[model samples]
Target: MSDAEKTVPESADAAAPESAPERQAPRTLTVRVHRCGPGGANARFDDFRLPVRPEDSVLDVLDRIRVETDPTLVYRHSCHHSSCGTCAMRINGRERLACITRMLALGTDVVTLEPLRALPLLGDLMVDMRPMFAHIGDDWGYVRPVEKASTGVPHGVARYTRLENCIECGACMSACPVSSGTDDMPPPEARRGGHEAPAQAAPGADVADAPQERMFMGPAPLAALNRELARHPEQREALLHIGKGPQGEKHCRRHLACSRACPSGVYPAKDIMDIRMMHGGGKD
Candidate 1:
């Protein structure tokens, strides 16, 4: 008990599970995922054993493996919840929100995760969304605006709240057949050219007819079209003009897969219907 003689308690590690070491060992979960390297070659399934818990989602497993075991195991994820659409990936052959897709719901102990197909894959489980967002802009649609009268009271304010819940997970685009194969399409970039780039119509060049490319409108714009149309009780005809041309409302195939896979339930198919009704009629 003397001040100088008193000793601090031994560290927990010094008196640990020497008698039952196996009980402290972490449990391993089987992870089978598709992988692609720098070039498109060497595509194959890569397996890894990860320490995981029953309540963990597929995203959680991928994150744990990437951080604790292997840094090269690449994937996109943000918000951890469904708020940010960064973590959308395929689980067990279906498009789903990896952050919410529970490990137990993944069926077999051997879980499989993959990137959204048809889009450009940056690495394992990461695809370029530039193409997807570009299609959204090309559709020339905007979120339908509520009138001033509707904003006066609480009842009107909440009218469009449900549609705003979309996280843009891109599961819709992954399910679309057109986005997978069309090569002439331009991926969505925020702007056409850099600030310093010369204007094509300044002098000798006839930039008016600069070969407007025929691009396939992807799901984000189609989803936006749906969101806008859902509230556009009056502007249906005008809004239909947004997606009217070759790459507009004419592209949707009425698959309804977009709505089925939307993690937040934005109905791109129904939106396409509204556009069709405004323009003329549905395709036969």
Candidate 2:
């Protein structure tokens, strides 16, 4: 072929690859939600079937269902990026933040969602978060001195502070068997050593008549206490008193469920263990 013909300009689009195949239709998901009314009256399970894209999160599905399927289906959510922790729930029997939990990655056709236990359940998936916050207490500081060397403090600033990692999602509380009193955990006397068992209730007396005791203060609060202690050594004595109280780190039972359920990387179990070591509890 002549040089001119041989060198005929290549098509402008010749280098481009073939267009991608058509995207598949979204998959349908069966979301089974645990429902309850005020004071847990008329509790039931409601199933919602909807089409979901692979990237769709559990919160997204719930939003679609609420708008198109049922407006009355109630749940709490804010800041869908998982920072708010408002959408935390039991996803397929594990504590997870719905905002970040993708529907397709669950590897199941059906997704079961339930509210965090041990908190006062309101209608539908909503629960009273007040109790969880109460446990964390009012004095626990949310911000800490920034430690990264790359992010230097601005001039005239004594130090920089950033919000702590714990979002107070209550996932730790839900996952903690001791805090929720689920999983048929043995009594304190049975779990602890060198402690005398209390007198048992009379056989004939009504069980309801007996005074109920408070369980552990839970991983979130204990973790917060630890953080506070780390930030303020002057408060060590006061904070340690709380940590070593009746509802303290000693009752953790070392399940480590809180660490697994935490999406914020707080590692509450490790903090509890640290508190134990600090107090000479010796890692029981």
Writing each residue's lDDT as its tens digit, candidate 2 over 1-284 gives: 48846754468675466585666689988999989897567989999888988889999999999999899988999999978888899999999999999999998999999988666688788877876677665977889977765766679987777889999889998888766666354455464545333322333332223333445677999999899988888878778877866667777778899999999998999999888778532333
For candidate 2, give the lDDT of residue 278. 83
For candidate 1, give the lDDT of residue 173.
77
lDDT of each: 0.65, 0.79
RMSD of each predicted structure: 12.6, 9.4
Candidate 1 lDDT over 144-179, as tens digits, reads 444345434565464342225667778877765544
Residue 199, model 2, lDDT: 24
Best by lDDT: 2
**What is the alpha-carbon RMSD of candidate 2 to the true structure?**
9.4
Per-residue lDDT value at 110 in model 1: 81
Error of 2 at 123 (Å): 1.8
